[model samples]
Target: MASSDEEKLSQQKEILNLQSQEVDEEYSKLSAILPWDKFSNWINCMCVITFDLELGQAMELIYPGHIKLTEREKSNICYLSFPDSNSGCMGDTQFSFRIRQCPGRVKPMCASHINYNHNCPVALQIDPGHYFGYVYFRQVRDHTLRRGYFQKSVVIISRLPFHNLFMHMVGVIAPEYFDNGEPSIEVACHDIDQWPTPEAGATLNLPLMGTVLQVRVPSHSDKPGLSQNLVVTTESAFSSPTIMPSVNDSDVFKCLFPILPHIQLIWELVLTGEPVVVMANSPTVCSETVLALVSMILPLRFCSDYRQFFTIHDSEFKEYTSRAQAPPPVILGVTNPFFAKTLQHWPHIVRIGDHVPATSNVKPHKLKKGGSLKTLDSKPGVYTRYKPFLNKDKAVLKRLVQGIQTNRPSEVQSAMLRRHFLEVTQSFMIPLERYVASLMPLLRNISPYKGTPRTRPFDPDEFLKSLDFSGPQLTTGIKGDWIGLYRRFFRCANFEGWYNTRIREVNRKLQLLHLEAMSDADLQSWVSGREEVEVVDLILKIKEKLTTASSNHLPVSKDVGEKLYKQMDAVIYTLPEDLRAVLGSN
Candidate 1:
């Protein structure tokens, strides 16, 4: 009877103890552990140009203003120049080289802009991400009408070709500059020329890189004209921000990497729904894919359109051949001062113009008995090409989705799957857009000990009480520190990334359960228990710590996680002979 009475009392006291825990959790709301989330990636883009005669020498130079290369990247540069097809540039020579181990910008050209595209026959293109600002060209001269203007095609670059272009220069219009809807910048033509320069285009003396320059409408002379309304403060001076893969301004790709202006321009178009002139012979579909990325998707992730950038290099490419041998020229349209040829990967290297190498007339030896030549095999028939759905054909949203299922284009003309892809890129940007929002301390309602979706149950207050922690939430503070960096990387990943997907699953599970009804007390207990993993949250925690730790010094926990990993690796590398034999004893 005495023992039974004691057992009853113990049960009642345990219940009462739990009740006390609930009360403490209610009143003693200590800050939760911080979420650590940090991530990073490189934003890459490219550009291409076709003009009369390809760049003369093997080395080339291009300037896409917003992107600058870092000193470290100066070494990966390679420039490959190839010979023009059977035809020769009218008085112009065609020469080319393959990119090898050269660094810096490599601008190729000779001493003329003629009808070289028709003459220089063969061309080889390298993928954009391989090296920055890898340019290809076909020069066209028009003395019949515009005297000597060249037409060039600009292309945005990708790790592979067909990716959208990125912009190196951005036209910034600050709030003070926008009194009305117009920008403070006033553009005018110095030697007024029309688009395409079709008829008697004004022959203007352009800057070194070779494109025509436009005069400003609000021409406050550099020499301070009378009636100056312009307020040129030291801060507001026209200090052009360089755009490119320069070390100082690099993100994921190294600094000094050369992504061209045209490539950068294309990426901007995709991210912001801007329209690029889709060339008839475009390698990949641009407009449709861009719409899927920037407008519909960017908004989903909180990404916004920023500045507009361009490269003076592409503009100068118009007459690259004429100026190739006339001293390596600077990119035209770049507002900055002259840059050195040393900035190019090669040191003043020029493709010695192609001339007939002296050949001696000699008799050829007969073929060996076993090596009789055979006639060429019958020419293989061309395979049926996968056609893409035109954006015009997919003007509506519903049609766009259906088109993704039907018109499947790949390798160069592949925006046929835009409807499906757009959603992901949109999701990828959320991490960046939500950087500040996710860290607000007041909004977190999920209890850590309760582990609603993933953790096992534990008495929230009791577990915390036994921890012997005199410190502020070590994990939580660390999380707070990295929230911004993590969010940025998360959003950039389009939510399809591994971490983003796991988090979505957790949120979904929470929504399914009536988790709101559970008190903070219940949630806290759950978090403390082992039921939930909260993998994304855990990863963020690690990321937060990793930020301060050297990459080599990431922390290793000694909990079951550490043990499980060790057990796994142990199986791979068998135990010592004695230890393996001793397993039976256990």
Candidate 2:
């Protein structure tokens, strides 16, 4: 009996070891897509802010107190964590926003080598980086207090765009902090510190205090319906609330529902990187709506700056409000009414309100004129008169209205809306992607003797010339002024960013092709007609090229450099004895 028991224990231990090995191997494969070494932790800092009757909003306690913050940063953080009293924070509210990092502050370093144009999502495009603050606030009426109310918020600061995961963590941590105080925040922070680095397109099983939150970060290459699967699965005996689906899921549909008729127009505005402002009475709505607007042109990222939630106290208030210059291509979400007068000069303004009752007389399909810029009305509509190049898809409007009439689940309706937008965006991008590919020079034109070839500059007139023969009109079966739409897109930041990225990719390909061809060419033939000094000069030039190819500044493959090295070795052996000795000494 003892021998049998020992054998069973040994088998169990071996199984556990095999499982651990498998997990490690899987992680290694996923992490290869991006450099994970630069990222240190999942959550940078976790803190609790409370409303003190005398001091107003103040940081009550922050775990891992070693994080340095300037007084100005601390003040702004405290105020942002807590919502305005008029925002109607009855039981609980959740939101997120971006904050600019002060100069010389220590922050997570992102790998500059990753080609953001292809792999990374715009959410993780931190070239001009900032800190994302995820907050969970709660308020309740309390006669015992001087203000007759009690309010507090728990905040998480992260450099990553783990929106769904971090929001889930804060939801769990905040309630526990309110109940037990500092210990809860400390335990939650420790758990977050142990999490694996966030790799794009990777699903992670993050263990919080007692439950596991399963989440996936959207990859740049994800197909249309893949994002719907970004759901949570709980593993612990203790029950945890289900985390809302990721940003790509139906949550965006909820934000776009009120403006469903004008969605395509709004999408164009975002794709062109036009200035946009989303206004709502609640900060949560304003922030979510802004984020949703940005995602409309996804797969193709909106490269211009955007603020999920903007306050009058924000540092860029003056620059954004000034009339001294043209409005920068930016999107701002505001709950305060002050922006109405200040931003009146802006072109597009989307005003969102609480859900309109199904019985209300307002027509969901028609465009409505907005109220005077002075009032905070809840009516939802696009407050712009700018005409769209493409005609409205009346079929989409019919389906959405039918869903609302039949009381279909919002998630299903949202999925339908997302599918429509995805198809539209993909169709629009296909021609451009194809055109960019045509701009690359033929492989035969690449030569090491000459300077590296570049992709031809993008000309709107040249691209438009190809549209009549083949364009989105034929592919999508949707017709309108395709020429006009492309013309507007040419002026936007999105097009510029996309064009520049494609140019870089094409240039890199040209460099690699040159290297490969030079490696295979017979050096003897070229040197036979040249002076000895010229031959020496050529050898030194090849060495310099090899050095540059190996450096991080140039994105050349290692195997290519090795091939050139082997070719040089063979050439050196064939050189005259005197030349061979001179080359060997160097």
Candidate 3:
């Protein structure tokens, strides 16, 4: 009797200890919900631009000023040029901003405009998130003439065949300049024309690796301009920022790696729905890093619209020519003085041109056995070979996820963790998607035959063997079993006609239930201990329905029904014995 009393006391003590722990957990969770003021700071909008540049190139930003301002009123102009990174070279790209005082006075009205008293409709004002600008011409007297807004599609198409390269360069470089509290930027014609041209005078032969030039803006008196066209010149001997010299792709990545975290931070802090554009003339930039970072940090919609990249060299130019096409000439837009003349020794290094054409001729031996085949529509030598890489990447990702879960990491890792994670995910998605697309033609399709639905004949097992299903979520516990069940239901069958019909029916009903349950957020509740009817109970209910249908003299056979029942039972038995017995008996 004394022992029984002691046991009861111990049981009560254990119950009380569990309750205390639960209460403490609840309090900790509540504490994590910060007050309203803390989250308010994250919502504040900011704009940012991230420039990807090489050693010699530089972007010059000339802010618009009131035309009426005299030479004395203009702010102190700083003429800056960075020194070469290597011996007698300007390599590093730097970021700097200056505040220009706007002239307060409004411009005098035109004499014709004063007499007519008409509103000026020609002014171009772009919306906040847009990135491009347009111009339309019209006569003043035409009654039918209407104003047209700039269409992004038209602008993009017009810029092609070099559109791809130009836009990609813009995507990488423009964000840095325009993310400063502005939705859009005025991409003027002069801006494109004024790209730093290679000139001997631009380079400063300095001992230091980094150089910043501070000079006064040349006044009108220095040049005495405004004769026929605009020829604004810098009074100081120094030139605008020069383009960076050509380095290997690996070196470019290394230079940009440290700045990625900061770039992410800037995007987070500055972005408040308004898009940004940064202006810079980078000679060589990595498209992989640029697109990956944009997809991760910006909204997903940017992927379709903003993602672009430029490549100076095409590895497989021959494959492209089979479609009866000619490559565009590479246009060297950089008027920056030193780029062309100084780098003449490097013939292999074509700095920036839209078209440097290559021949598509192939040797007769590579065509076929004993020269039997002369031409091939699809080039076997240059086809997309991505499946092997996709499988490898998927396997590595699965291992990475397993490692993370097993080790259980602590917070306070490096800031680049998120960036790296994004890079991996983006990198995996590209090749995997390509591989899947390549297999689409081989996928079986269902067709109707004599008023009955017939599934196309294919070896489901063989197809499964070809696929790489190593994704972490697709390879674990219940989810993994579900995938196997889907595969087996199609591939494995004792009775072809009856089993296929019944199993398909059951599959459809289960799919509907799953969609409904998931949509209503009741999937967890249905499977939880609190629910009287679990998934097994639902399966049993389906079994009862099938039994009833069979009794009505349906096409389904008793043996086929029995086989499916066994399969369902197998699934149930895979669970804990206690849960299975309770659910199965029901």
Candidate 4:
């Protein structure tokens, strides 16, 4: 009876302890979610810029003017906000870009600075010293206005890639500000200020002027099978918020439909980070086409520089157009006709326009052999005749064409394109991922007494040799000259960035493993075999390793080093009192 009672008491205590821990964890999570900082605003700054007849471009109002900005940054912002005169008589236009932040400026913790790489296998590699700007420009004919034009732009600058969210907010705010003026802008800024910290893959309910918008920021590390469908709802019982599509969900079909036949070649060029130019009739077309081209290699972030809307006034205009050297590896989207003559030296030029049907007299075969074609009237197509390695997916083209004929929803068409690109990108990346994995050293090879084993250097020729046995063709079951494709890809900037990042990651893992092995070692046995001087040298070395690991911000190494320190301290205590005193004196 005594034993049974004792056992019951112990079991009850364990149950209570577990329940207490559960409560503590739940409270911690709640605490993290609540207590929003008053100073943290979703938007870092907002600017209302107008075209000045006398000054060229001027800032009419920079809200919360305390935000420090250099002259160069202000100049770039003002110029980028307004479209050039070439985009003649535009009603309203929206575009997004990234610009380098002012040097040495302290970046605040806001939606833009939130690290999106939490729990990601690979970090979202981007220039951390830049801010992304979403601009909404409006041009109207007004007799009362100076220069007979009312031209202005509302610009939102932030660190977040909330393209769709910012666009939606600006769409409402710009129109209201245009009609009612500064008060409306104040209200919009306040609404954005009240938003919760934009957590990756979390649905947020944002309150805006008697309505609530439900939105989700797409995460870079989103799992393959997870639901990425963005649900946007409003407070009204009869209405819903406009569904904002992400960059990934943007309509590639509309952008690429005119040049569908040459899409494979275009994809290859982009993958290799080739200098390509996209010329379109409108700014909207020009920017969207550039984004669409970049998106075709989904899941693989394009690390090279690209401008969605490149203008003659842009700082890089001269560097990009200089004829003294080969064009830098960049993709530029331009609307001005002047680019046609300036960028003629570029390797690939994609001219986009509305599809024009061929007249009965114009035969496709006859035009193919014409060496002397002299007009822009030549059918819209990719100017370069670059051969594509991978076989083009006929099914994707057929489906997109069928969708157009049947008048399918734009969302549906976008989804189809996203799916196709996701598959294509994954198929291309799988072999590379596998090959890199093979280069890592086995666990048994790691030792506490020796230096960390380095990952084997990547050899292009050796990798190509392994393709026949295990490559994209076998992994994806897709027919292609993948070996040839990779041969070219090796020469590109994207491959270089990917390889460097992967190498760093592998080295980090090796260091972590070495530290863990040292922590698990028998320090007493190690010291027993060494002389006094050798033991002191070992102590100094361990101290140096710990300092280096901590300074480098390597969490795993630091944690293991702590354990190793305790083991070393125990061994030191086991030494003679005279020796311990001598060690302590040093």
Residues 264-342, model 4: lDDT tens digits: 6678888888888887767667777888888777667677778877778777788999999999999988777788778
Order by lDDT, highest first: 2, 4, 3, 1
TM-score of each: 0.21, 0.84, 0.17, 0.82
lDDT of 2 by residue, 19-61 (tens): 9999989879756532323323455577688888789899987
**Residue by residue across 99-120, what tens digits does model 1's lDDT show?**
1112445334211111121121
Per-candidate Cα lDDT values, in order, are 0.25, 0.74, 0.28, 0.72
- Candidate 1 stretches with Cα past 4 Å from truth are 1-129, 132-141, 144-165, 168-280, 284-549, 553-586
lDDT of 3 by residue, 264-372 (tens): 2222211111111111133222222333233342111121122122211212223211224422211111212233232222111112211111112211111111211
How does residue 119 of candidate 4 score in lDDT? 29
Order of models, best TM-score first: 2, 4, 1, 3
By TM-score, the better pick of 1 and 4 is 4
Q: On lDDT, who's better, 1 or 4?
A: 4
Candidate 2 vs 4: which has more TM-score = 2
Query: Against the true structure, candidate 3 has what lDDT?
Result: 0.28
Predicted structure 2: lDDT:
0.74
